[model samples]
Target: MLALVSAPTNLGLRPPQPGSVPGASKAPEALREAGLFELLRVGGAREAGAIVPGRYVDDDATRPPGRVRNESALVAHALRLAGRVGTILDAGDAPVVVGGDCSVLVGIGVALARRGGTGLIHLDGHTDFRHPGNSGACASVAGEDLAVAVGLHWPAIADIGGLGPYFAPGRTAHLGHRDDDERATEARDLLGAVVSAREARQTASATTAARIHAVAGTGYWLQLDVDILDPDVMPAVDSPDPGGLDTGELGALLRELAPRAIGASITVFDPDLDPDGRCARALVDLLAAPLTTLGSALR
Candidate 1:
């Protein structure tokens, strides 16, 4: 069975403006309002309640030198999120986390680290690899999740609870990054498996799944940043790039991947950008089938 967890937090993202909070914080409720919970319930999922996050504070101006935006708040949220996910895992249910931003990966990483040697299938439009080593624009942890997850960033975010390098690079697979991503070449060299969006479209879903499974690791976690879908189809994300998977392609891939995952986190769908709820409905429709059968392989 899948346990639905809502980790509605936007602490990792830079505010749209100085005083405004990132709208992604409302993603969980928006998805619920669009009837995602009902569909999942019909598919035999139980709601696991929500993890309320700390208040969003745009500390950009006053942020300490080595810290990202909302550093303390983000860490606090990840700890709480990890605890909830851990509880769901202990109960023998796969968690399907509805998230506020890509930084949710940090929490999931911590939870999986506790279990020992779980791989990660990172499905995102961008590699989200910018760290202090790579770029000076490191304020948004959401933009650097993959790096942090693999312990490529500062100790504060990466070594949460002293569990640094949650997923080893050799055990992690990155899929759906654009061919032109600045980190594409480096990620290919670092990660066990790296598949570009274009390559995935050309390859069979099973083949892609096989590539991920071939990584040197045990059970894997699936991280879905909705921007992996083409901006033409899913423009409501904070960063919508040009090239990405279509709804059908992503759905097919997820169907193949989800069942093999121990748990999955869905992130980066901004309801504020989807005012009419069309995007939310589309997102729910796209996810319902694949997520409904999440972790089936384990069963």
Candidate 2:
């Protein structure tokens, strides 16, 4: 069974303007309005309800070194979201978390870390690998989640609940990052596997699956940042770069991976940029099948 969890948070993103909030926070609602919930319900999924995050605070001016924007709030939300996801997992239900942004990975990491050994399959257009080791400007968890998940970050965010290195670098596979990403080559050296958007687009799903199988432990988590889709198809994200998967390619990859994933999270869609709801509808269409069919192999 699959449980749909709503995680509406934008704390990890830098504000579009100093005083303005990012629209990614409105993603879950927009997706629901686009009939995502109803489609999943009809496909035999149940709603696990929402994990409302603390209000976003623009604290960059006062934040200390190593602290990201809304750092405390982001951690709080992750702990709470972890609790929710843990409950769903405890009941033996796969969770499909629809969220505000990539920062949600911290909470998912917390939950999975408690369960002991687990792997991760990260799909995104950017590496999200910035950390203290690579950049002086490491203020956004959204951009640093992969680094945090693998424990290449400060202890505060990475070691929540004393559970650090949520997923070991050897157990994490990265897919869909553009070939030209600044950190792609460096990330390739540390991660379990690196399949760029260019490669994923050209390779067979079965071949990609085989590569992922090498690093995916007995079980794994699927993290999807919808910006993995081409900017032409999914420009509603905060950063939509070209050289990403098209709708069909993304869905194919998801269908192959979801059946083996214990749980999954979809993030980084900004409703603010999607004025006519076309992106939401497209996202709903893209996610409907895979979300409903997660963990089917186990059954």
Candidate 3:
């Protein structure tokens, strides 16, 4: 059976307020309404639920303190969710998690790591590994989430699921990264063997699939950040960069990878930034392919 989980909290960055942001509030609803879970449930899916992370509304005066609490809350929530999902996996069921941001990977990585050494296929425009004191044009915590998961920044993200160094360099691979900030560059240097967007474009989907399969060797988790798509093609994102994979290419890659990898999860961010639901729908379609397989298998 497949257990679908939803984490609707944007921890590192705040999702734009409803009505103010074009499609933010409706993104999660769209996922649910699109029959994402219903499709999974069609074949006697074991369980499903949406989790609301504790809100830590950003405040200037209490920003520092708030971040401390917010990170803790996010970690706690992730651990709780991981434990729940782990329980399902222990019983031989696959877990599919829908997320509000890439930060949710902290928990997912830890949970997967607990089962065994799991490989990572991180699909994003940026490496998402900001060091503790790294300064950049956009100094946002969201950019550093991958670093935290990999144990680059311990203080900020240490206690999530008691899993440190969630993934090793050899166990991790990146695809569709077009833009690189200083922090991202540092992360790439620290963790070698990342496939660039140009390379992904030059390489066929089959080649990409082979590379991921080779690197992962066996079971692995897929961390998808919607910002990896071209801004023109997917305009709604907290951090949109130009020159990313197209919908068709991305869908093909996911479809190819899903069957090869042992387990996987996806995260969608900044849906509020979407203007006309173009990005949201595209994301849903991209995910629907593999999810349908999961549904069929469990059914």
Q: Best candidate, lDDT-wise?
A: 2
Model 1, stretches more than 4 Å misplaced?
A: 216-218
Per-residue C-alpha lDDT of model 1 across residues 208-252, encoded as one tens digit per residue: 888888993435899999999999999999989988999999998
lDDT assessment of candidate 2: 0.91
lDDT values, one for every candidate: 0.90, 0.91, 0.66
Write out the backbone clash pairs for model 2. none
What tens-digit string does per-residue lDDT give for candidate 3 at 1-299? 56777777566564354323222323456666656666557755545677677755544335453243256667777777677667767877667777767777777766877886577778888877665556432223456667766776655464454667777766777777775544556656656357777788889889888877787655667777777888888877777788888888788888776664545666555555654666666776677666555423223
Candidate ordering by TM-score (highest first): 2, 1, 3
lDDT of 3 at 167: 79
Residue-by-residue lDDT tens digits, candidate 2, 99-212? 999999999999999988589999999999999999999998999999999999888899988899999999999998887889998889999999999999899988898899
Question: Which is the better candidate, 2 or 3, if ranked by TM-score?
Answer: 2
Error of 1 at 180 (Å): 2.0
Candidate 2's TM-score reads 0.98
Candidate 1, residue 196: lDDT: 92
